[model samples]
Target: MTKAFASQGDLTEKKITFDEVGRDLWAFTAEGDPNSGVIIGDDSVMIVEAQATPRLAAKVIEKVREVTDKPISHVVLTHYHAVRVLGASAYGASQIVMSEAARAMVAERGQEDWDSEFQRFPRLFEGHESIPGLTWPTTTFNDRMTVYLGRRRVDIMRLGRAHTAGDAVIYVPDANVMFTGDIVEDHSACYCGDGHFHDWPGTLDRIRAFDLDAIAPGRGGALIGSDRVNGAIEATRDFVRSTYRPAARVALRGGTLREAWEAVRAECDPKFGDYAIYEHCLPFNVARAYDEALDIDTPRIWTAERDLAMWAALQG
Candidate 1:
């Protein structure tokens, strides 16, 4: 089944849509690829999530130019994943904002993560040579920080942990739109490689508390209506729960990693087999869930070599 999906070749790169949510807020998304949020302030612009490389982010920058030539003053990182960040320097934002926890994560494992992810998805980081180094945050904050886009208020909050330890959601108060970085995916697949299985659901609830009218998830289409927004959130929560629960149940029984992996494959494959990166993500997802079910809090680092060994052990 995994081979079948790979045979379909990579998902074609789609044109990014600059969907207007409110006066100056726009959601820039290209299929299930990394998304960026554009907030036009009175004097400048704030961009959320820098694609993957400077070359990749250049396209997003092009879109931002269409609206305003205001210098990109701030680049807000929702988390410190290689795909989500790394491209930040391209924006040349005066200040790069991130959660202190995220900055710490980068300090601890940024290099390993960069190597691991580059090996996993070569196509996403096509211009890998163009990357100078791991992106470092110039400014770090704890809990929540609010920035005004002139009169518009954009609240960057570390609303619990879902995708990674230092995850944030951008809330546009006047527009009632939230840019949830991998916390909520629409019809696209969910990447649970380094996730907190036990706490992800509760974190989703925390995100829902914002009562957003529209949301731009980490990937996939922009959720337009309230029902669609709620639907996307529920779908993401369900995907995480469904993927983790069965694996945890197997682990509690003292099952081996292979057994836990098989359990998840059997349960999720039938439903999510066709989703992008299902084959790539399942091994890491099961491994992390198995560790968490046995009381391992911090997930072990995944190197390129380790990724291959785990995949062979689980699915070879």
Candidate 2:
């Protein structure tokens, strides 16, 4: 029998873990579900990656309240995925920040992405009605922006493109911690449907250049200590390279998309098959890698129609 579309069959609720990764930084993870990072600055809080909906974000807020009462003053969208940004309203943050490229993506494909993701993963969109609308970034920057919550410094920088053309990381220089959005998933599959395969490794190198004591990745457990941080980075690099390289080679050799898909699965499944969302992400990841191998510089927008059609073709 055919597998359920994307994560539709994953209905069981995951156990949530709110652990302090650094002095004041917390990682809110849920058994490999989408994770969020909390930076409790001296004066206020900065939330990285809003949950899927306001109801979901409220759970994150409850965890934040357990630690401190400082208001969530800012919400940062590291990229423009619907699961990451649709919950922005719940935070009541004064400023919603994102990279300029991310802002453009919201304007261009936000609605389509919202529709696509809602269909793909119904469980994550539990409170779909609570979403005010497409989350908009009130503030945007091209390269980097610095915010000071009292004496602590939080740097939001768009190092390069990895998960998306606009991916950014929240760096805490003083604490030696980084909230790497989807750029570096610890044990989870990197959703590369909207990624830049060729540019991703370079982006990972840029992330490695930082002296990180801890990393709250987009998924999986928090990496605490420099050794764990480096390990996660290397694992992510290996995952990206292993998935893209073989698939790209197949496409460059005049192979069909199915051939490239099969090649990628043959190469990646043995190593990363058991990882979170590995099966759900494989088809899209291979599709993007195949296109990129043939020199498609930009990723095509994914709509609900496109999602179903692609899944049908690949899974057939």
Candidate 3:
């Protein structure tokens, strides 16, 4: 209310890049905005991480058309975040997939997250009116499921919790490439508003163990080589560690939230100050980190009102 979430002021349109990360694997990235992955198989295509609205999803559709005429047979939601899953209808895919945990979160706090994210980043919800409603997965999996687009094998698994309790990763064995949701970011701030900070690093390790050749990360550019891919993974790990360590120290000492906030800032700013959405994500990240450090396992649902109240507290 005082100023606005930093992302609210980010109205500048980013340049979209539809890059080929692997053989028929494409990454639709728009600067540091949320990204989507396109996997073209023998008979059809699978989309990973739908955009915020039908209008935005149309942009990814346009890119998919440029390369393949195959029908979009599946839409895989890496998590239940509003920014990533609200554009489902646009795909018209026969199957929409999400982890059981992700679907449960949708039933529990999906609408609240939608309202909260829409308030935080107005630019992303440009075609909010076009969204039919909250996106729901027609198909759900417990821990792992293998969906094949013709002969192409895509393994969808919940590696560990980072961005949210329902976070999942889509691994394409042939390409040795993985589409990680917010579990890992490249030169972009990890939005921990609903994250599990302690479990995040181990998840990154699980991803790294695959020795991926490339990664279509949740945000930032598509990583195409071992060096760049591994760099992003380590950097993401460092960002989480840097953020939580200071906040955890403050919380362990029984300091106030504001004190934890200050402690986190002093540690993280030097490293991630210039990262995409850095300012927009910092308060929420610090708050969640402090709570998790204090042994709060599940992240509290973030609503529109909570967004404003948290911002006011940090700013004051």
Q: Total clashing residue pairs per candidate?
A: 0, 0, 0
Per-residue CA lDDT of model 3 for 108-149, tens digit only, reads 999999999999999999789999998999999999999877
Candidate 3 Cα outliers beyond 4 Å, as residue runs? 1-3
lDDT of 2 by residue, 1-316 (tens): 7889999999999999998998989999998889999999888999999999999999999999999999999999899999999998999999999999999999999999999999999999989999989999999999999988889899999999999999999999988899999999988999999999888989989888987889999999999988989999999999999999999889988999988888888899899999999989998998899988888888988989988888988875
Per-residue CA lDDT of candidate 1, range 136-231, in tens? 988888999999867778899987888888988888888888889998987777888778877899988987887778898888888887898888
Residue 167, model 2: Cα distance from true site in angstroms? 0.5
Per-residue lDDT of 158 in model 2: 94
Off by over 4 Å in 1: 1-11
Residue 21 accuracy (lDDT) in model 3? 93
Error of 2 at 112 (Å): 0.6
Best-to-worst order by lDDT is 3, 2, 1
The Cα error of candidate 2 at residue 56, in Å, is 0.1
Which model, 1 or 2, shows the larger TM-score?
Answer: 2
Model 2 segments beyond 4 Å from truth? none
Worst 10 residues of 2 by lDDT: 307-316
lDDT of 3 at 315: 57
Query: By TM-score, how accurate is candidate 2?
Result: 0.99
